[model samples]
Target: MSSLENILYFQSALGFLANMVLLLFFIFIILDHRPKPMDLISFQLTFVHIMMFLIGGNSWLADIFESLNIKNDIKCKVTFYSSRVMRGLSICITCLLSVAQAVTISPSTSLLAKFKQKHKKYIINALFYIWILNLSVSSDMMFYVVGFTNVSETKQMQVTKSCSLLPMSSIIRGLNFTLSTSRDVFLVAVMLTTSTYMVNILHRHQRKLKHLHSISHLRASPEKRATQTILLLVLVFVVMYWVDIIISLTSFLLWMYDPVILTIQKFVIYAYPTITPLVKISSDKRIINVLKSLQSKCHQIF
Candidate 1:
């Protein structure tokens, strides 16, 4: 196999492995004695991550299909649409997760805290809307996507099928790009602002507690732990997303549509969702206990 094929294979294997681990981690979280609201959110996030991985894995499979000279139109469309929907869903859920965490950690005086009693229910409602919004924005792509045979002659020599948005006037393409970019920037700003507020509140809360007690450690409290976990999750999300945005923007500005850059973008996008469940498992005591119990049961069975 060529180097490109090998690279795709390795990446696909890694993505699949990560998805399996995330699935197992979330399962343990769900089986825990007392799952928290955050744990449930993490569970839902990880489920979406698994779907993202599966969708990404299809890209690698498409490569393999090309290597085998399999030219199937239905397979191409299914892969294309599934990947697009999964990507859209992943982005929406990630923003939702950030908003959920912010609400969870908001100070009592904050307007968001007024809805504390109904936070989980609100999150559920928000999640429903996120999926709907994503679907509405992306559904038009269904009419535009076509397999290899339908693309321009310049791209016809490519073995793997191409799925692209239909050609539009330059003005229309510009408008589409502008709208998409504006929405993305707005969501990113919201996530960043909310995360920053949460971190500041957590810091002030920790300092206040520290001043009140010199002899007692402040790290052992459930609230403190939850705050730390959310902060860490937010930090990870921000860093990964910003890196992706930088790379994507550079690629777009340079007009360099290299497959390698696209590959890297896919890696980052898939990695974001997949890591969330594992992070939750590592930080959550109840999930750790459940995983331990499962390990013990498996050993006994063996």
Candidate 2:
């Protein structure tokens, strides 16, 4: 395999394994005791990332289809449509996570506190709506994407080796772009707003804690750490999301993708999902305690 293909496979494999581990950890937590709303959100996010890796893997389903001699058009529609839906879910879930964490860390006296008691129910309902919205919004992919042989050479906008996007009328194209851009912009705006609110709350909280405890005794609280981690994820998502958008727009306007740019785009696209599980594993105290327990057991065996 070429170096490019190798790198793609490496990314897909690494992300798949990391998300799987994170998902298992969440499952352990949920099954062991009452699962928190945060845990549920995280579990869903990890699952989405896993699906993304599986669908987009360099040597996975696409290769399977090729080996089975599936029709190229069927392959294009299935792969592209699935990948697009997962991408939509990734952003929506990330946004939901940010908002949920903000609410999680809100002061009890604050207005957001009321929802805390019912957060799990609200989260479940929100997730249902998000899935329906994204699934419907991305339905256009199935219509516009086709096998390379289905479209004329001049009209083809290649997305993959076998898949190309068929051109649409100007009105349809404009409306599609508007719908997609509006959804992304609204979600990102919500993420930023919630992130700022969380930071303010943390600052006020630290000040109060400072008055009650010595500086050395005031370790980072679990709430603060969780908020910080979610903030970091939001920042990463925003950066990657816009960069992906820019690349997509440039390619759309030119009706062609530069190979190097495409590679970089995929890197940017996968970076957030790849890093999220690692961040959670490192930050969660429960996971750390479990790891320590396992290590002690291993030493005893030796």
**Of the candidates shown, which would achieve the greatest lDDT relative to the real structure?**
2
Look at candidate 1 and give me any clashing residue pairs: none
Q: How does each model score on TM-score?
A: 0.80, 0.92
Best by TM-score, which number?
2
Number of clashing pairs, model 2?
A: 0
TM-score, model 2 to reference: 0.92
lDDT (tens digit, per residue) of candidate 2 on 19-126: 998887888789887989988888889999998887776357767888999987888888888888999999999999999998898889999999999999999999
Question: Per-residue error at 109 for model 1, in Å?
Answer: 3.0
List ranges where model 2 is wrong by over 4 Å.
1-5, 67-69, 150-154, 214-217, 293-302
Q: Model 2 residue 233 lDDT?
A: 92
lDDT of each: 0.65, 0.85
lDDT digits (tens) for residues 88-207 of candidate 1: 666566667677777777778889888789877777787778777876776554554456554454332222326433445556645655776677777777877777877787778778
